[model samples]
Target: MIAPAQGGLRVTAVDSLAAGEGIVPGLPIADARALLPYLAVREADPCADAEALARLAGWCGRYSPLVALDGADGLLLDITGCAHLFGGEDILLADLTRRLTGFGLTLRAALADTPAAAWAWAHAGPGGVLPVGVARQALAPLPVAALRLPDGMAAALGRLGLRRIGDLMDLPRAPLTARFGDAVARRLDLVLGRASEPIAPLHQPAPFRRQLAFAEPIGTRGDIDRALEHLLDGLLVDLDQAGQGLRRCEFSVFTVDGGVQRIGIGTARPSRERRHVLRLFAERLEEIDPGFGIEVMTLEAPVAEILPAQQAALEGGPATGEAELARLVDRLQQRLGRHAVVRLEPVDSHIPERAVTLVPALAPPSHRPWMVEQPRPLRLLPSPELIEVTAMVPDDPPLTFRWRTVLHRVAQTEGPERLSPEWWRDRPGTRLRDYYWVEDLEGRRYWLYREGAYGEPRAPRWYMHGLF
Candidate 1:
């Protein structure tokens, strides 16, 4: 039971057992309890239900990459070119229904040329394949509710004795639009395949993918390597013809025991070099377990970008050196993990700590140009370290300071660069900070700052922010 309103509890959902006893959703809890004195009830969890639906949508990717959610209870699959891979539409639907039934789910599937037509048939017409160019004829008999109108509009149409979609089909379009508004005609047109209705897939489909299915399962490492090489060769040819190159590649091995093992690699830049891709995968190919032999292998380039043919230089140049460095970085990342290799990028901010960020080596270069006007430390601390300072004035650079319990005398001082917190960020109670570049007696320069103003009720605090 779920309380959708303040004063009453309602049956938002019911199980098969309760439904069999004439209990249905939208029934008042009082009436439902009266119908069955002994009933089990639990609060509804729409968030969990939505999460479960998303997981199911992801699982449906095996059938078609273009799968989308239709409300909370249904899914839409665009299997235009994918159905033939599983034999035919009928075979694919049967296999899908059987598998979902095994997982204890009740399902109704309908396939048509348009998503709107397919959605209507899934709820009203019997679950089956609806051939192309017959959406209007096939959907004529279903209820007007199949058009997915608002509840009030559907009820209003029913009151007018226009319960069946066929009744509205033959009526003049101008009268329907004048009486029920444009939504009625629009929905009707969508269902009749007169207007376009496209499904937005949960995931963007990869543009380039190659697959090889073997008649007999192969388990040896040699067989796996050969399959990968063949897939790479084919994928590179396609990429070359299209004038694009792979930025990220994924290799999937489908085992005979119904398990899939996948390995992925990323390049520093768009590349179509077959040797480079194969070498990156070869480093990790041994990690994939055959799991009772692999039956199918697929290579997918989910990320690709344009890479025009490059003219060979007369002699070795910086381009060759950069390519070698990129390959080395890729190899090291493959062995050590992605986060282990990182590059510092400058961020557009006045705060010292927020001035630069660390990103993966393969990530694109920072678009914000680095600021070189102010001399900053070579290394900034993760967080400021509080220290005690003795200076001529609270706002001035320190003469001596004790950091990590070591007292250092000031040899040279450069600045009291004033930096204020960003007011637009809406940070309350944060005050301005005056920064300094001070060199100690030992000739080690330090970046220090004093928070708040001088001679305030709360004495300003000093912190060592970075080292030079």
Candidate 2:
């Protein structure tokens, strides 16, 4: 119900009825319905409104990187020198407003010497250009409430017959200070373009964006390749200033015909080195199709992380680096997608399969040793299957067991290594298991378990879980 710009309950939206059909923000739903008789209402969604604001902010980025969120429904772009790119300030503003209107957003825009003056006129006075000295005169005619004062302040001032900004502009500062406080004087100074109001833009937005204007469009990958280095050079400067290293990057080549081609590369370690970054991108250059001749190229890093330089000789190995190993890993990964090349990591668990896991290697390999103390099988089945065992229930290894229709009489047995159920995990679907390690007459070793020990119905349906 708040008009975020003025921070008051003011003219926010209206219905098709004559502009003053008694509809406005902060007019309670019940009261509005009583006044209008056929008032339609819907709950305001802060999330949907925020998403729309963010999309508008993205579009505003084309005008300037220093675009700050103005209010819940507005954006403030510090166009500065960026306006010259579209010719002049008037042409820039006109084009921007026209483009946004085409996209179904109704906007009220104003430009002045100061952000505060522009915002004030845009919020209160109708949208237009109030150049320099004319801004104060334009804003002075609007209601005194446009200074963004509180309800009590507005009502108190209204009661005193000072209903316009111009009415109070030339009043004695001492009298206003004694009654309305210093805040009133400061707000008035800001709206009159006397104070410097700094615009705090969105933090560290992507500055790697680059737009290249081409006189002759290049239709082949080779032609765009000549300009690719320059775009990457600009992006490198941005990355250097940001003090970030990239492990994964995407290059988008934009064509004159509104089509885009993207190429991506992932690294074995985070790197900001210009040569190393260029080397990673070099492998994918062949796939870039410059359809209808490319006019712009944008290089972006979607994933990055800190990579501290590692001393290779500290672990007692020769002083050779892992550059070759990293290169091989990157090659395999790029050809087969991320999941195709992986490293086996040891997990802390007693169950053989759970003891080890596969993870995609995105960074340089760590030299940590695999988990010790537990003997692991040469192979692990997808899931540990149930086995029918003739054993001393409650303890000890099975004397004989039936697995996969082949009843193997145990020639030698080891373990009731006493693997207990992981009940602490609250794994509702997991049944209790007791295991045995046994070697058959054929010299093949088998790992088997009983689903539940103390006798139950279906009498232990057996299965072959693993082989070693």
Whole-model lDDT values for every prediction = 0.85, 0.69
Tens digit of per-residue lDDT, candidate 1, span 1-468: 565654588988888899999999988888889999998888888889898888777667667778899887889999978888888998889978886787678888888878888888998889688887777788899999988997699899999999999989999999889998899999988887788987889877778888776868999999999999999999988988888989999997877655667799998788887777888998999899997888778788999999887764543344577778788888888889888889889877898787778897757775777887888898888989999999896566899999999999999998789899988873887888888899998899999988988677888999999899
Local lDDT at 80 for model 1: 78
Give the least accurate 10-residue stretch of model 1, judged by summed lDDT.
310-319
Clashing pairs in 2: none
How many pairs of residues collide in each model?
A: 0, 0
Query: Best candidate per TM-score, number?
Result: 1
Model 1 off-target regions past 4 Å? Answer: 1-7, 211-231, 250-264, 278-299, 310-319, 332-378, 389-401, 407-462, 465-468
What TM-score quantifies how close candidate 2 is to the native fold?
0.66
